[model samples]
Target chain A: MTFEVENVSKTFVSGDSDEEVIALKDINLTIETGEFVSFVGPSGCGKTTTLRIIEGFEKPTEGTVKDDGELVTGPSNQRGFIFQNYSLFPWLNVIDNVIFGLNINGKPEKESKKRAMEYLKTVGLEDFAERYPSELSGGMKQRVAIIRSLINDSKSLLMDETFSALDIQTKHKLQNQILKICKEQKKTIIFVTHDIDEAVYLSDRIVVFSRRPGMVKKIFEIKMDHPRDRQCQEFEDLVSEVIEMIGEVEED
Target chain B: MKKFRNEYTKETLILPIILIIIWYIVCDVFQLIPSFMFPGPTDVANSFVRLAVSGKLFKDVFDTLYKVLFGMLLASVVGITFGIILGWSKRLETLCKLVISILRPIPPIAWIPFSIIWFGIGIGPAVFIIFMGCVFPILISTIDGVHRTDPVLIEAAESFGASNSQMLTEVIVPSSLPYIVSGLKVAIGIALMCTISGEMIGSSSGIGYMILTSTSLFDTGSTVVGMLVIGIIGIIFDYIFTKIQERIFW
Candidate 1:
């Protein structure tokens, strides 16, 4: 499940006027199997656009994304996507939402339901299985969204600012939970965020981008072990370093 | 809250009771308006009881209901089917837009002459008119509902490899249920109107036919009864649909 973004560039033309807006230009990056990579940059840096290209939601103008050496063309269940607002189907209850991918793929209903319950239990949401998305709190809903993707056994997850809407305490709790789940399941995650602390906290590698018409400014390898303390001096120092890089990019 | 609701219900009855009393005074007690032209409350009541006892009122009511229900069923099936197809394909919808707009503005009653010519006098013409009246609202609302489907939800479905049909059934249809139900509510009212007018113009049976016959015979009491019965039916259908709308939204 390694992904290679080779010389990818995207240009969006305005509908009324023919003015071209370059979202990403000459982007090149390789994410290894089971790696947790975060794309961190300023707003409109095309970090999200780049992530979308890899997920096969948007096509790149110049190049292609290779998922395990197969050229990405369109959306596939093999790669799950998590949106910032937790786009769980409001009509579906928690268990139904989690099992949606499985159901659509024609898995046996009883088996899918059983497996969905197991996943919900891991997130301590088994009690909320019968409740619809509207009944759940923000954090709970996001957790359901994550479990929904996880249950599909997607080799990679393309998350676009998945936790940006949560309160601080909820965000930290989810970040910890996601870290544990991805580590245990060995699923590759390509996370997009403006939060440097979140990137440092979750990602194995943080790929920083330059402002609009974005390309890789730098890539930082976090050589920290699991359950890294945010209060630790090493964590604080790394956070500051990434912040400095982004600050310099902002000035430019 | 309970007491306030009770007071609200009581308040609603006051005006209707006052209107009935005024009508009684004008047409029955004083005998100002002739009985042949406009029946009093007592005359209408006696006419209602006579029709009910003879069973012609129930038969006419059933005939009208049958036409309305049959036509609505046809309209819903066709409307929802076409709506989903048109809603999904932008090109198809664009191509049909002009034709639909042209057809939609023509009132269902306006089609009565052609309907009578095509289907002949009886249930056929009435049903056709009802179908015509009901279909457009349903089709328009369903199309609107489809268009209003959240893009993110569609993206999520696509990402999970949901096929086009699967997307329509599982995601699109459920998301649009509220709008569809509302459209049905609108269609029901239109269907009733079409049934009455259609029956009055082209049919041999139904509440509208009874009203037409009674009025022409100068039996104003029976005519009033027919009108009141239609109003009651409309209220019942509206109440049922409102409950359905509430349930689906939740």
Candidate 2:
């Protein structure tokens, strides 16, 4: 099912001031099923806001987001969101954290555990299943957070700078893992990132956003397959293109 | 574990020993205060032995323990439940905020008169006072705990399709556990204090009653013994609670 964001504009009012701040202005996009798309922009560009709208966490002041012609009302398991903060439950162990969505969805305990373990095993964290989030490293915790959403069989994954907090090496490693998993599952992804390189490397298409009062400046389709070489001329070219687009937005 | 236990034992014993030596020097050697007014450490020890043999110490300990435990149980049940509800519902919190603000600052001792009038002189009033003392701390802590929960966690849970009740039980409650636990710690201290105060003001039994009667009769050693028991019990309760906190939260 295709997801459509139509003429969406969001306005935010500060608690103290009467002045209005338009965070997003008349943004529009269509995300085809099983396609990988990335949103790249500077801070305050409303890339995160756009992702939030898609997940139905925040309603746009104008326009609508439809998933296969169904109006998105509120947060649903159908559109999974991976936060910048790992947001793994500190109290729950790795396995339990991974199975959280299934638990909330009322799946039987045995089946949920089996599904959680399978995801954990794929991430090679099955051995750490009983360990709490505090014991896991940052990358491991984020993996659990991803699996937490994935086990629900969400139609799309909306990542909000999920790797921005991690070190470069760990971030790249996780990017590879996420690419592999998304490809294997053929799940649609709308990844938000400030890193143009990441956007070019992972996304089938990149939506470059302008600064404040965020509007789509350009959309670049990457004509490459999975496991795109980061150092390759074309990959670097696309990354430079995305950077130039954002740089132009900044200049404007 | 064994190393930790040994260190803990050694650390705990050192202060009490030093304090006892100082007490011996002041009251026994120097005879700073008259024997009837302030007892020596040895005298307090002798009083403890005497009370233990006579079964009065155990009985008073039991009486005080029963009141604090019973009151704390009731307080926990009511406090945590109401705290979660109020913390989640802004309307409920707004309705109760003024009442809580008005009631919270008025110490459990302030409710003693009403408790006595309402429930009479013995365990009833003591329990009521202790419940009042314990409940507010637990309730406030629970509210703060739930309120202070990381917004990111709530957002994550919502995106995972957690129902409101599921959010409360799984995310809100468990995440707030540290706050609730610390609250329970405060409640334990307050509960113990209320139990003793309640007993001292009106009851014929309990450690507080014994201390009151002994002090009035100039039985300073017995009074010191009661005071020491309460202090030691408070320390033990704190120690146990800390252990539980370490196991659960850390």
Candidate 3:
């Protein structure tokens, strides 16, 4: 359940002319078992690059990613990634979309449908099992995505700004649902986000990244309890503290 | 933008109507090309009525339709199968590029002499030409469709443990549906045109043949009537395809 990333770096050679753009620097971080971690930084700060490397979508230039003491080389069912983009099959309905992953695992059609329905109901989308993903709202789509990843029964989730498209109210609602699911399932989740409030609201720890050629500038442990209130002075102060950290890193 | 389409169509009719009036003035009013050599729209309409009464025209119409339909069906199956394979495997596609480039430039009409030599002077030769004309457009579009499928979508599938079969069936095909359908529409039109041309050049039946025969007999009105039918049928088929695209993909 614990995850470790050591000295990970990436440099993308842009264009046919081969201009080198360093995307990630020597990034070293460790995530504890069952802990919820969030990576927050400016756009194009290589936060996505780091998460991708951990999930084995892309190889790190200089380091190895270890998940629960095993060297991670490529994607495994042990870790689920829910992307920021909808990425739903427009041709498939809601439950079918959720069951899509399970069916790929060689689960029987009937059994996968049953399991999919169970997860759909968990996300409170039981009525929309037959409706296509294109018909779902942005927030509802995110819920489907979360359930889709959860259907694999993975113990860890690698979420890359999964709620970035939802409006404020929808984002809040889905975040609450994610928190609840994580709490009940005891799943360790590493979430990536640029929003200050979201990182504070969902994370057990927040790792701030500096600009281009990103490296971890600071890692803050949120000492506050679950269901943390945004109205609370401590929560607001912590949010401002993280905001200041982000601004200071950007200027530097 | 959508709200103004009806009004836009209505306004656009003015230019076409004026052009028709000018055409009428130049032909019917001016007595162009002497009466026997060039008939007006009225003569063409009369020829259409005469052909419809005798019922000989139906067979020609049926022949052309059957050839085009059969050819298009065959072309679609062959083209789509090859297209999927080519798009899915880059190495195989690269190897076949030399063959495809060499074969694509040969016009369907150019195949008529060979088609007759191979399949003989009947429906078989005509359909071959039609299929050849239609197949390339379809294959090209399918390759494009597969290429257009987002790499992110493929990566998402890969992450989920989707097998090669599953990825092809679930991710690649469904995502490429829009492009495939568009290509089919284009191919169908080309198939019909090639069918008409093939019939005119070789066969003794079909709408295109009717025009060829009328021209040889110097029946200008009948020739014009055959040309009109072919044109109308082409328009109708195109219209049907356009409607289906809007209805399904809307």
Best by TM-score: 1
Candidate 1 residue spans exceeding 4 A from truth: B1-8
| lDDT tens digits, residue span B143-250, model 3 | 888998877777777778777898999999887777788888888888877887899877878888888788777777788888878877887877777665654451
RMSD of every prediction: 2.5, 2.6, 3.4
Report the C-alpha displacement of residue A55, candidate 1, in angstroms.
1.0
Measured against the true chain A, the candidates' chain A TM-scores are 0.96, 0.95, 0.95
TM-score of 2: 0.94
- Give model 3 RMSD, 1 decimal: 3.4
Model 3 residue runs over 4 Å out of place are A108-136, B1-36, B40-43
Ranking by TM-score: 1, 2, 3
Number of the top-ranking candidate, with lDDT as the measure? 1
* Complex DockQ, candidate 2: 0.71
Each candidate's TM vs. the true structure?
A: 0.96, 0.94, 0.87
Question: Model 2, chain B: what is the TM-score?
Answer: 0.92
C-alpha local distance difference test of each model:
0.91, 0.89, 0.85
Please give the lDDT score at residue A199 for candidate 3.
Answer: 95
Candidate 2 vs candidate 3: the TM-score winner is 2
